[model samples]
Target: MKIVIAGGHGKIALRLTRQLAGRGDSVLGIVRNPRHVADVERAGGEAVVLDLEHAGVDEVAATLAGADVAVFSAGSGNAATAARRDRMDRAAVVLVMDAAEQAGVRRFLHVSSINVGCADDPGIGEGYAVYLQAKRAAEQHIFDRDKLDWTVLRPGVLADGDGDGTVELTAGNPIAPKRARFDQVAREDVAAVLVELIDRPGTAGRIYVVVGGDTPIEKAIDV
Candidate 1:
C-alpha cells in the first residue's frame, strides 16, 4: 500500500512511517521543514515539504496522487496559542479531507483525541475543551462526508513505553477510575492499530478508543 502521512515529523507519525516502511509499504510524508527529509528517508519513506495549514488543494491532491491512504496526524505544537491550534488542528483537517477527495484517495484515517466524546466529566475542560471541540468538528466533517472510507482513532493518553503491540479497544466511553492510571497506550501500539485499520474494511466509519491491554493489537480489535 502507498500511504501518505500528514505532519510526518510528528512522533506518532514517524512511528507509523517506520512500521509501514519496514513492512515494504511505500510511504510518503508531508512535512513543512526540509530538515525532516533525511529523517523520513532514514525511516524508509520519502518526504515532501508542504504546509497543511495553507497549501493549495490542487497541489496537495497532486502530491497525494497514487497514494492508497492518507493519514492526518498534524497538530499545532504545544507552544502554539489557542487560535493557532484551531487553525492547524481544525482547519488543517478540513483541508486534508478536501485534498483527499480531489486526489481520489478513499481511505482516510484521523488521529483524534479521546476527549472529543467525553461525558460530563470535570477532568476535561478549559484548554483541553478547546482542543476537544476542534477535534470533534474535524471528525464530524469527515464522518458526514460521503464516498470516503474514514475511521477515527481516539487513543487515550499517549506514552513512550516499548511497543509491546498490545492494545485495548472499546466501542464507547471506558474511562477508568481517577486513580487507576487514566488509560495510557504506547505510541507504537497506536501506530500499529492504524496500519491494521488500513486493510480492515470492518473498521471504516467506526470511532475506536484505544489503550494498553494484555491482548495484542490485532486481537484487541476483535472487541
Candidate 2:
C-alpha cells in the first residue's frame, strides 16, 4: 500500500513508518523540519518536507495525490502552549482533511488521545483543557464529513516500553466496556494498531480506544 503521513518525525508516526516500509509498503512521510528528514528516511520512509501548520491546501493536496491513505499524526508535542494547541491540533488536522478530499485520498487514519471528548472547558483554566478542546474540535471536523473513509484510534497515556504485539482495543466510547486497563499504551503498539486498521476495511468509520492487551494485534482489531 502507498501511504502519506503527516508528522513523519513524530514518535508514533516514525514507528508506523518503520512497520509499513519494513514490510515493503511505499511510504511518504511529511515532515516540517528538514533536519528530521534524514531520521524519517532512516526509518524506511521517503521524506517530504512541508510544514502542515503553515502550508496551503493546494500545496498539501499536491503532495497527497495518488496515495492510498492519509494519516494525521502531527502535533505540537506535549509541551505546546495553549494557543498553539488550537493551531496545530485543530487547524492543521482540518487543513489536511480538506487536502485529502481534494487529492482524492479517501482513507484517513486519525491518531488521537484516549479520553478525548467534548470539553467541559467553559470556564476552566487553559492547562489540560486546551489540548482536550483542540482534539475534540479536530475529531468533530472529521466526523461531520462524509467525503472521507475515516478511522480514529484513541490510545491511552503513552509509555516508552517496547510493544509486546498485543493490544486490547474497544470500539465506540472509551468507557463503554470494562475490559482492559486502558491507562497507558506503548507507542509501538499504537503503531501496530494503525497498520492493522489500514488492512481492515471493516474498521472504517469506527473509533477505538486501545491499550496494551493479552491478545495479539491481529486478533484484537476485528470490527
Candidate 3:
C-alpha cells in the first residue's frame, strides 16, 4: 500500500508513517517546511514539501497520484489564530479532498478531534470555539462528498507515551461520551487505529470517536 500523509511532521503523522514504512508499505509525507523533510525520511517515509495552505489543488493532486490513501492530519495546534484555523484546519481539508478526487485517490483518512462537538457550545474560549467550528465545517464537507471513501477519526485529548493498544471506538452520530479518567489517548494508539482503518475499506463513510479504553484496538474497531 502507498500512503501519503499531509502534515507529515506532526507527531501522530510521524508515528503512522513509521508503522507503515516499517512494514514495507510505501509512505510519503507532505510537509510545509523543507527542514522537516529529513525528519520524515528518518521515520522511514519519503517527504514532499508542499504547503497546503497556499498550494493549489492541482499541485497537491500531482503529489497524491498513484497513492492508495491520503491522510489529512494537518492542524494549527491549540494556540493558532482564527485565520490560521480557518486556513489550515478548515480550508486545507477541503483542498486535500479536492486534490484526492483529482488524483483518483478514493480513500481519505481524516484525523479530527472529539472537541468538534463543542462548536456550538458558548462556554469554551473563543480560540477553541473557532478551532472546533473549523473542524466541524471540514467534517461536514467530507460527509457531504461522494467521490472519496472517507473515514473521520475523532480522538480525545492526546497524551504522551505509547498506549497499551486498547481503545473504545464508536461510530455514527451520538458518539460515545469521553471517559473521565482515561479520556486522553496516546498518539501512537491513534496511529495504530489509522493503520487498521487503512486496510478496512468497508469503514468508509463512517465517523468514529476513539479514546483509551479496555477493548483491544482490533476488536474495538469492528464495525
Candidate 4:
C-alpha cells in the first residue's frame, strides 16, 4: 500500500516510515525541512517538502495524489506555546483532512493524545487541559466528517523502550489509574501499529488507544 505521512521528520513519524518501508510498502513523507529528505530516504521513504499549516487544500491534495492512506502525526512539541500548538496541532489537522478528501484518500489515521477526554483530575493540570482542548477540537472535526474512512489512535504517555507491540486498547472511555510509562514501547512499536491499521480493514471508523505490552502488535490491535 502507498502511504503518505505528514510530519515525517517527527520522532514517531520517522519510526513509522522505516517500519512501512522495510515491509516493502511505498511510503511518502511530507516534511517541512529539506534537510529531512536524506533521513527519510535513509529510512526507505521518499520525502516531499510541504508545510501543512500554510499549504492550501489543492496543493496538499496534489501532493497526496495516488496515495492510498494518509496519517497525521504532526505536532508542535512541548516547547510550543498554546497558540502555536493550536495552530499546528488543531488547524493543521483540519487542513490535512480537507486535502485528503479532495485527493480521494479515504483511509486516514490521526495520532492523537491520550490526555484528551481525561476526567477532571488534578493530575491533568492547566497546561495539559489546554492541550486536551486542542486535541478534542481536532478529533471532533474528524468525527463530524463522514465522507472519509477515519480512525483515531490515542496513545498513552510515550515511552522509549523495547516494544514487543503488546498494549491495551479501549474503544470509549477507557482509563487507567496511573499513567502508562512512556518508556514502555519503543517508537518502532508505535509505527508497527500504524502500519497494521493501514493494512487492516476492520479498524476503520474506530478509536483506539495504543501502548506497549508483552503481546505482539497484531494482538494488541485486536484488543
Candidate 4 colliding pairs, count: 5
Models ranked on TM-score: 3, 2, 1, 4
Q: What is the C-alpha lDDT of each candidate?
A: 0.83, 0.86, 0.89, 0.81
Q: lDDT score of model 1?
A: 0.83
All candidates' TM-scores?
A: 0.91, 0.92, 0.95, 0.90
How displaced is residue 98 in candidate 1, in Å?
Answer: 0.6
- Model 4: clashing residue pairs? 158-182, 159-182, 159-183, 160-183, 166-213
| Candidate 3 structure quality by residue, lDDT tens digits, 172-221 | 45332332222788899999999999989989988888888888888887
- The ten-residue window of minimal lDDT in model 2 covers 173-182
Model 4 agreement with the true structure over 160-222: per-residue lDDT tens digits: 655666666556432322342342446667778888888887888888876666767776676
* TM-score of candidate 1 on Cα atoms, chains taken together: 0.91
User: What's the TM for model 3?
Assistant: 0.95
Candidate 1 lDDT, 110-198, residue by residue in tens: 99876776523467656666676677778778778787888888888889866788888877422322321258889999999998888
Compare the candidates by lDDT and give the number of the best one.
3
Lowest summed lDDT over 10 consecutive residues: which window, candidate 1? 172-181
Lowest lDDT 10-residue stretch of candidate 3: 173-182
Q: List the residue pairs that clash in candidate 2.
A: none
Q: Cα RMSD (Å) per model?
A: 3.0, 2.9, 2.1, 2.7
**Leading candidate by TM-score:** 3
